[model samples]
Target: MNLPATDRRVLVSGASRGLGRAVAQAFAANGDRVAVHYGSRASDARLTLESLAGEGHVLVGGDVSDPAGAARVADEAGQALGGIDVLVNNAAVNDPHPLATTSYEEWAEQWQRHMSVNLLGTALLSHRAARSMIDRGTGGRIVNVGSRGAFRGEPDYPAYGATKAAVHALGQSLAVSLAPYGIGVASVAPGFIETERVAHRLVGEEGEAIRAQSPFGRVASAQEVAEAVLWLASPAAEWSSGTVLDLNGASYLRT
Candidate 1:
């Protein structure tokens, strides 16, 4: 494992709960300072902050779907952290909007929201962080949290799958463009993770079917995904730029 330098500043977006909070904790566990970003949940964000093991961790809040909001978040985090060394794009929404059952107007709304937040928000943050890294001559890391649904498909959440697919593409493109500046870019596509948000489904009648999707007879945990993100952001993964690591538990194989 390529261990990152001590005291590296990490910015984890949408860290109010679930995988975002887990990722923040992982960074803090490694003695890194973190700037946790949340959308609108101050209470949840505070919990994340309190759960962190180290000092120098701060919280920033904003709607990633808003261009100006995203910029403010980036700036605030950079200033609070004294300069961000690693950016984790973990903020996203998976609103259900099936084309067949939804109205055209609603579909349009969902698509626009997903595209604006998942793709454009992440792109803008990456741009700002990359510029800071380049100007400071500090090689940086960018880890995007994508989803296995991007490849396997989402019948009820078309926008979620589409945005994830776009995110994967964005990571690849940025990896090449930022390579010259010593910046590494990569994405992780996870299968159904057992986050608190999905705890009900995991315990519901569908639980067995979902578990059966993986040969392990279980789904991934929040910590499992967080571990992968930590690895991708490590200095040892410098050569792993442009890679899209999948955490699907062999539920869906790409040929």
Candidate 2:
């Protein structure tokens, strides 16, 4: 990616590993100061901070599922970064629970957890960061990490898909509301990604079927998604706000 025109203070949530870690590294490489936030992975977050290219990166641990906790985490990051110019909402949890086999209790728990972490967590974090940027009188950006399941639907993980859909909708709403404040909002919807967390599924018997979902015959990589987030948060792409960029390698087309 091209270097940013100016140094930015960036806060990346769920940056302990995978895509979040990559996003943090990209920002650091762009000469941006970063606050890496993780829900319950201090060691992994430390590794991300250590892997960052530049100095002045801090690791923050907090449970974003709680509104107060999310605010606290955002406050700490904003202070450490001397005010944030970018916020990447990437923290989420996905657990499989198909309706055919799931009890009502299990379904209820899944929805609650999914909404808490995926939608509420992101909205609360963005609210805090946006408020900070408004007070600072500096235009900033908020990029949400969304998923293709939001558009295509998920039979086994309905809660995951529903929350992602909400995330995208939330981005568009914020884009309109925060436009005057100069805080652009957007999201990236990606298909199956090649990550350690899902390595077993990718290499399983259904591996070929998964790859065949895309015309490229392969899933996307963490770095690819990170690159997209990096660009969306850049000034040049401010006009792209409210857009949900599809990074699924042509796997699922939305009309």
Candidate 3:
């Protein structure tokens, strides 16, 4: 995993644990100064902070739903590492509730939380990063952590799915607009990842059935998904802009 010495600064949101943690670690392992952002998870943030692969870690704590939070993260990262070269938007909320029985408050809360962080927050940071990249006259990369639920439907969690869909759409538009400025925007969507929070969502046989659905007969790991993000941000994939790489094991096809 040889990374260019020049690509040393990257920002990852929701990096306290799980997929976000893996993405942060991936960049850190390759010698990138990582800004690990967490929303309301101080202890988890501390644990992730300890596990960072490099000394250039900057802890950014904030509510990603806040519009100003993304810009603040960029500011902190710039102050910590001199500049940021990559931005990974992975903060998300996925509390499941059936739409039929879902309360207006629940829907509004989820939308405000997820959309604000996942979509709006991501845009804000990417916007800031783009400005910096333009001023430096070099290309930059924006990798968005999206979900298969955006294209496919889940039994529950309609709000979560919708927000993911919006993320994809937003990525596409950003990719087009940012290209002239030497900025690459892409989305990485994963299917049925095996994470601690999702363990409770499955029963004994239910888990097996879900695994069987994938051609690989297994769920994706956080590290696996993170690897995809790394590649997209890497110079090797410089020409690959506006791409939505589905990291699923052929479980579901986009088209």
Candidate 4:
């Protein structure tokens, strides 16, 4: 099937909820078929699939932290969607492991988990999707969901910060390597976002302080970040390849 440029096949990892769900919905609203990928939340993924505005969306489940699982995810989504034209690498693991209190074993475990999911998962999936795009000769877009913590630092979750930094670098590397094949790659470093997973932290005095970090006096919404991802994946954004777009609302300025 020859889909219109505006209605390409999109694969959104971690789309079971939160920002991933928002990204999937945005593409579906734009008339694109979406493959909603989930790690463990099958029920939540089904809800996301149902919430999409368009048809032909599918639910794909896999553990992105594992090499085999990541490969399976890309293959399943590609087969179901009839080839992915846009790949959103949004799956990640962000758990706190403070150096002052964490044990060596715990710190090592956290680092391994973060690297496997945030960095390795994104690289493997991008390779799979990019290969498919190259074979199809249609070109594609790869938008990685990085974090502002990559630059501002995550004292409490050092692994997350480090892995996200690596993700940004990985995207830049792939952008250059894949450009000749017509694949555009980019990353979004978002600051604090209001989502179900982090709703508990968005309350009380701590929440107020978090919100105050941005001059806007509020954290970003999932939809807002999703819109940026959507734009990055659009044909008009081809020139934006190799760019790391900051969506922190001026919370942290980099020089």
RMSD of each: 1.7, 2.2, 2.4, 1.5
Q: Residue by residue across 59-116, what tens digits does model 3's lDDT show?
A: 9887766767767878887788777788899988887778688888987787677677
Which has the better lDDT: candidate 3, or candidate 4?
Answer: 4
TM-scores for candidates 1 onward, in order: 0.97, 0.97, 0.93, 0.98
lDDT of each: 0.93, 0.92, 0.83, 0.93
Instruction: TM-score for candidate 4, please give it.
Output: 0.98
Regions of model 1 farther than 4 Å from truth: 1-4
Please report how far candidate 1 places residue 239 from its true position, in Å: 0.7
Once superposed on the true structure, which residue ranges of model 2 sit more than 4 Å away at CA?
1-4
Candidate 1 vs 4: which has more TM-score: 4
Off by over 4 Å in 3: 1-7
Task: Give the alpha carbon lDDT tens digit for every residue of 1-255 in model 4.
Answer: 122467798999999999999999999999999999999999999999999997899999998878899889999999998889999999998999999999999989999999999999998899889999999988899999999999999999999999999999999999999998889999999999999999999999999999999999999999999999999999888999999999999999999
* Residue range 91-173, candidate 1, lDDT tens digits: 99888998889999999999999998899889989988889998888889999999999999999999999999999999999
Total backbone clashes of candidate 1, pairs 3 or more residues apart or in separate chains:
0
| Best-performing candidate as measured by lDDT | 4
For model 4, state the Cα shift of residue 214 in Å. Answer: 0.7
